[model samples]
Target: MISKRHADILKILDSSGTVTVAELANLLGVSTETVRRDLRPLVEDGAVHRMHGAVSLTGPTAEAPFRRRMRENAPAKQAIAARVAATILDGQTVMLDTGTTTSFIARALTGHRRLRVVTNSMDVARTLAVTGGNRVFLTAGEVRPDSGAALGPAAVAHVLQFRADVAVISAGGVDALAVTDYDPDEAEFARALLTCAPRRVVATDATKFGRRGLVAVVGFDGMDELVTDAAPPAVIASAMAAGGARLVLAG
Candidate 1:
């Protein structure tokens, strides 16, 4: 029988690829010995792998597809979303690009009323459209089956039609040079959305720190703020300082 504690451990591993045993013990409010006892059966069954002082998911369960990315670093993404949502007021217009972090942001904004949302993510649209007395404009474009994001020229043109109070985007990577994306169409669409808002915010998790993606979305100079779960590397921090973009660390 899987105890509730066992289930909680799996959930944590699903969100964070690896975690120290001490961290898990702290999170579960148990002693290290207890955690070890709970992990024994799970390890024996090959549901999780044990490192010297940490644990991680095993085999195919560790793979991160788009849907899996939604689960990855979930707590960090949620914290980032909460920080971004705190800056947005009710009845404000928000522009968002498609990405897993932005999808988290959409859920965070559900409490706000009368929000005008413009987005190219079907997930974002579906999340905010039904609740909050908000009006959501979903762009028409070539929808990627993997992410349910509308991309390409049509999406860019659709986003260009509206100006917003704020634009929140997600990144595949954030290095010293720029914020970047894995897909060219996603990058192009994000660039267009950035132009539509005076306050452009990039929300990414700590795992993206120092990674370089295939396509450049924008340099720090192009954005007003960068929000993440942890402090960036010194080089990336220096670049953001040089570019005059505020760095917001999510609590």
Candidate 2:
């Protein structure tokens, strides 16, 4: 049987994706040694993965589900979202792809007015459609149960039909070479969004820095800007500079 403490730890991991040992110890009102003891069984069961001083649901290769991803690095995501939203004009047309960060961007945009939003994310559509007198176009295609994102060729075709002022996308991982995603269909969809707009922005938290992803969405040359809560590592920063992409750090 899972102990109450173990269950609580799982809950925190489920929501936060990763937490430091010190933070967990503080939250649990226990010593670091006690937290380590509780984590051992969970790690053995493959319920969580341990790092040097922290724990996460698993390695970056396995993408977390949408709800969990939304909760993960939430404050940083919100800050990035706000920063991106501020750069957008009140009445500009925007193309957005499906991802947790982009969902936060949609929410941050609720205060703006007369915006035309194009997206494959049901979460983005529902958030922006009723507020701000925005016209939201939800792409048509098969929806993924985990993300509620429309995917496949039909969705790509739907996105290509509109021209927008800006395109904002979230990535699963971002290495020096490219912005990437775990799902091939979503990566293809993001590529389409990039083409539909002149200004292409990638919104991701710092956790994605230097992480490897399964599918390449776009090379840095194809990106206009990167919005995040922290500075990227040297390799990534150099790549962004070489590609002429601006890196905006959010508070």
RMSD (CA, Å), each prediction: 9.2, 7.3
Residue 168 Cα positional deviation in candidate 1, in Å, after optimal superposition: 0.6
Where does model 1 exceed 4 Å of error?
A: 1-64
Top-TM-score candidate index: 2
**Cα-based lDDT at residue 16, candidate 2:** 69
Per-residue C-alpha lDDT of model 1 across residues 56-142, encoded as one tens digit per residue: 777664663456678878999999999999999999999999999999999999999999999999999999999979999999899
**1-251 per-residue lDDT for model 2 (tens digits):** 33999999988877666566767888899998999999999899888877546677754554555666787789999999999999999999999899989999999999999999999999999999999889999999899876799999999999999999999999878899999776789999999999989999999999989766678999989989999999999999999999999999998
TM-score of each: 0.76, 0.78
**Candidate 2 structure, TM-score to reference:** 0.78
Best by lDDT: 1
Poorest 10 consecutive residues by lDDT, candidate 2 = 58-67
Each prediction's whole-model lDDT (CA)? 0.89, 0.89
Clash pairs detected, candidate 1: none
